[model samples]
Target: MYPTDFIERINSLKKELETKTPLRIEDEKRLKKKLRLEFNYNSNHLEGNTLTYGQTELLLLHDKSTGDVKLSDIEEMKAHDVALSQIEEMARENERPLTESFICELNKLILVRPFWKEATDFNGNTTRKKIEIGKYKSTPNSVRLRNGEIHEYASVEATPAMMTDLIDWYRENEPSMHPVQLAALFHYKFVCIHPFDDGNGRVSRLIMNYILLKNNYPPIIIKSADKENYLTSLQKADTGKQLAIIEYVEQQAIWSLELSLKAANGEDLEEKGDIDKEIELLKREKLSKTTNFKSKNTVYDLINHLHDDLWNSISLQLLKFKDFYEKANNEIILNHELDQKLSLTIRDNFNLFKILAPAIKIAIKDNHLDSTDNFYDIKNLLWIWSYSSNKTATKDIEETIEMNLQLEFKFYEISLVNNKYELERNGSLISTTIIYQSKNDYDTRITSESINNILKSISKQLIKQIKEEE
Candidate 1:
């Protein structure tokens, strides 16, 4: 018996898939219209460009008989157009780009009119023979396997029985797995089955996405750059090393989710602030001379402040901090009011960070002095305050405070010492003693300067040792 929730589930999955894939606006509108007509065939308005219940069955039969070919050449051009339009529309809506390979696959599915027998690779080579197996031969169209072994791809001659069984298994089992893990497994199984010799990869990917889309997860694009890694993970999956595949898929899913959000906001992933570039430039220009400079503390402090500001700004821009209260160890509460407040604070902080980072970096580079002591001191104070049990700050508040402190520290340490300033300039007199002196009869002194000086002196001596060795 057909599953009771099959139609509802399919619709839900379709909606999700549509969201991730890009579609021409016109195609999207047409698809909606067509789907409406298809789903509401009994309505009186189903006279023109609409399939009756009987006609729908006929269409299905035709599609199956033609080996699941997409209709594009029926006498009723409107109907044919609608069907092809819906397919293209669905593909585009899911933001699935139609590369040449994809187009070739689509052509293979053109049941109404068979066009090309095979798709050509980059070198224009076509696969013409069927794949040979132990006792059974399968389609020759197959992806490269990692162990330098190739098998007959399975999907091409997949029976309706097999498809039905697989679909049932997916419906029953997928809910138990994490969405990312499920997506990966589903993709692997679908591809391994090689259901459609000609368009198995594309269909398998589409089906994998269907499951994820149904679950409200984003689509993952295995980029050409990471194709090898992606294939390697698949190979691991085939060998029963499921964990590797799962991790790879999870990472890809997270990346895709982040990218989706960024794309929606019309932001480029590669965009970095001018301040970072300037800091890099300064490091390249000043490192050699500063490497030998004494009193390198000033440069270090300046660099730290700049680095902190840059990262602070970037985080502020990307994250939506929700107001959360610690209930106990790791437990927290989230409510609407807190969420709004935290979000606003996050946005404001991000803007502030962006505006201040470049200015701070520029100032440090120009001033060439240790003007960041106050900044570091304030940050340390905030860090102590936020993490203290006595403090009643929200999690968002604590995180923000901690982030600011770390940024300041990192900026100072990385930029000044490594990039622009050296410790040998000030007479190489690296050591000093902070002494508290009283009347000489029986005097006592408290000093930390000695410790600080010792560290500096040691650092300088090490650099000298390295220099001498060179």
Candidate 2:
């Protein structure tokens, strides 16, 4: 259903790409590395694999899945990349025709093993279904859309027949159809059947690229950032506007071709600072493009990340004075609003970070916000943490945090700062840092060495004040 101009455009790009038949070794390696990582990352990420792009690259290169991530996600990413390699080999075997066996095998490889999955039966009941690696679905697998309507795939009894028909149709059309149209349509029909239980989405994408690679086109990446558009395009296709999805895939194909052309010219694939930008973009990829910054988001994330580490570092050294100040608490205020009024407390800091690296995500992805002004106070408290700067307070309100206590309370009152910190003892000053930027760069200092030094000075100052008063 492609327009004449669109088909001609792909053909023109395709013909010019053929002239650079044998790209330089370095260029080929760079392009392959980029494509392999991008495809595995975006494909799994779309299906909710929690590994960041940086984590994915580390896993692919050094076999290190950094950050707090699931063992299963690491294995899936590794296996999925291996499957990409396997498909590359499969695509090169021009003598062999595409088959259902290969597709099923690809699924088995990506999934790694059989597992139990939560599924919705046709009767609209939640059921725990056993998912076998490489097996077609035995139960009715359907999904509920955002609109609260059920979207059904082919019937369980008809799955085998439909899959066969799909494979037959693909093989028959492979020689005559434009590869982009062939791949896009195959992906559409296969996902419609929803042949397998869990990996259908990932497999459909893998096979889509397999079709393209067979025709010597670079693999197209449907980026995780554009997930809504990806799904919406398919939803429109479901409405009989088939060209909507084809056009979407065509645009991706053009990007792939342009990159390949750049590689053939021995040019850099990524722009300046693009790698850091990719990491940053992928960092927020889990936070759907639709997500707005909120308070539950701030306080929850505040407790999970380096905040606890900041506390642990400060408290451990301060522990020597446990006899005098056994338990101390910290709080945040906005215009005289108390901690009880705010959503944060010391107890909120737990191993909650193990759930998902500072953003337990599941912590609060809802409309429940503590502030009427769209949680602006919460946002400032989370990002630019400091007392003197009064970041947590609005201009209309007086926000007071203790940089240094009066020493009359027989203890030290500490404040988290945006950058620097100063400790005072009998009106003398010692400058150091308590909380600095974290590796993730998500928060303000709230440091170990500085905390220890400042705590020592303050404890001495408080003891001297107590003695003098006595």
85-154 per-residue lDDT for model 1 (tens digits): 4343554464453232442333244222222244444364863343221112243355545566655455
| Candidate 2 segments whose C-alpha is farther than 4 A from its true place | 122-125, 271-273, 277-470
Q: Give candidate 1 misplaced runs (Cα > 4 Å).
A: 1-147, 155-160, 263-470
Query: How many pairs of residues in model 1 come into backbone collision?
Result: 27
TM accuracy, model 1: 0.32
Deviation (Å) of 359 in candidate 1: 68
CA RMSD of all predictions: 28.3, 15.3
lDDT of each: 0.38, 0.64
Worst 10 residues of 2 by lDDT: 404-413
Per-residue lDDT of candidate 2, residues 1-470 (tens digit):
46734667778888999999788899999999888888988999999999888778767876643334555677789889989988889899999888889889999999986765677655667666779889898877777777888898898899999999998998788878889999998999998999998899999999999999988899999999889999888889999998878888988898888888999998889956567957665654444223422234433443433334444333443344334322233443222123323323332222222222222122223433433443333322331212222222222111111332111111112344312222122322323434322222222223335545655655554445334422
